[model samples]
Every structure is written in structure tokens, then in C-alpha cells.
Target: MSEKTGTFVVTHAESESAVVRDVETAQVHTLASNPGLEVHDVLEATVAPEPPLEVTWEVIDVGDRRSIELVDSDLEPTQHEKDLAADAEVGDLQQEERAGTGEIHVFCVPEDEVEAAATDVLEDEETVARAARLEAVRVEVRRAPDAGVLSVRYLPD
Candidate 1:
């Protein structure tokens, strides 16, 4: 079979085995060997199914790999983002893809829970990886208290 190449996020990794999820397709692959992979690592690689049973996959060629960064930005959300949040109901999340690369996510939350919600996003690995799918390396979390919103911007290096 032909090899598949794309961005993959390490969902789980250990000494013996590892699991990677394709960022574009959301397909999951189980690796027979860890190959020094670590959880939350994003890899740009070519993979092929193992011979015979084809029950597992192998990282045949690695092009690039990196760990995403999640940071709490002191910068406030942009005015447009604030307007988006103003239109959204509490507990709603709105996502917009950037014109070039990356994404902007505006989340409407309760005024009292803004800090906690921001912290939750910062700690969630899947959340970060989801944003990084747009070729982002850094995720900036900003709070707009007046709008009771949290703005998460996925940015390139």
C-alpha cells in the first residue's frame, strides 16, 4: 500500500507503543514501537502500514516534529473578537480560521469563571493540538473581561 503523509498528534506514548492521530483526517494509528515519541508532540511524517497483518503502522520517514506552546497572553482580545463574543451566548464557542494560517477562537463564558476557563484551555493538550492543526506553533490565551470572553489565538512561529 502507499504511504500517507500529514500532520499527526501523539495521543499516547510509552516505552513499548504509541498512538498518533492525524490532524487533517482524525484517523488514529497505533505504532508497534514508540520511536521515542511523546504525548502531545506534533509530527510531519510519512507512515505506512506494517507488513503482513497490517494491524499497525510505522513511521517510515519523519519530516518534522514539534511540541506546541500554550501561553497566557497579557494582550486583550481584538475588538472584532469582542464583538463576536458579544453576539454569542454564555457557554458558546465560536471559531474562525485566519485568512493565511492559524485560527481565532472566541469563547463566551460566565464572568466569574473566566480565569478558570482560561486555565482549563491552557491545560488541555487536545485543545492545543486542535488549534495547531492550522500550522500554528503557539497558542495565545487572552481574556476580555468586559465581554466575559476568552480569546484563543493559534499563531505561527
Candidate 2:
């Protein structure tokens, strides 16, 4: 079976199952439901054919998840945060490795430059060489706050 990637809009969700509509093909799919999913949530999944034209999907990620929204809201800059933000020069980058996953978190990138920064980080020869040794999975760029804070998550294979 081949794999198909697309965004699915959740139509109905229950404890064990969910009905979703694919944005690209307009096909409806049913799969095991995930907790906290609700109607209208957009999920990114890779679907593979099962049998008899039936398909099963494994969710790769969720867009606009509530936890992310909550985090964004919580990261709003207060007076102290604004002061700290002002002190740091824009375009500064910081990297830290997660304890167990070996995932790398690159922080403090300006929101306006995240896309370019992510591309540079992923395409750098040094980063490429290191990732080749680590067998990394993928790099994700995220905007953490409305005030232009960005972070990159580098996941390992």
C-alpha cells in the first residue's frame, strides 16, 4: 500500500474512533480517535491502504492544537519579558539538547526570520554532518509568542 499525506479535518470524534475529511481529495476516513481531538481540528496524517479500498492512518502531527495555543498565550510578554527581549539582540540563537531524546532545541530566533533560520540550520554543512552521525528524523520550526520568539526542534531518529 502506498502512503498518502494530507491534512484531515475532523468531523466527529468519540472515545475510540473519529471521522475525518481529507482536505485534498474530499474523501472521508475513519481512524482511532486521539484524546483531546474535537470537531474541526486539523490533523496531518499519512494514510495507507488496508484492504478492500479501506485505509488506515497514523497521525503525524496536529495543527493548532490546544496545548500549543495555551503555550502561545502563556508566553505573552510581560514587562519583565519585554525588558529581557529588549536586552537580547535580535537574531540570537541558543541550542540545548534534550536529556533523553537527544532532540535539539534552538531558541531565540526572531519570528520574522524563523523560516530562513530553520532552512539555514537544516542546510548547514556542520549541522548536516552532525545529523548524519545522529540519524535525525526531522526539524520543526515554531513561533512561540506573538512578540516574535521562535524555536526549532530537531528530533532524532
lDDT of candidates 1 onward, in order: 0.87, 0.51
lDDT of 2 by residue, 1-157 (tens): 5556765656677877777666556677676545566654555656555556656544544443311111112233334434444555676555556555544443455667655655565445344323323334344544544455555444453
Error of 1 at 115 (Å): 3.3
Model 1 ranges off by over 4 Å: 74-80, 97-100, 123-125
Report the Cα lDDT for candidate 1: 0.87
TM-score, per-candidate, Cα-based: 0.78, 0.34
Which candidate number has the best TM-score? 1
For 42-146, candidate 1 gives per-residue lDDT tens digits of 899988999888889999999998877778988889999999998899999999987788889999998889888899999886675686477788889999776
TM-score of 2: 0.34
Clashes of each: 0, 0
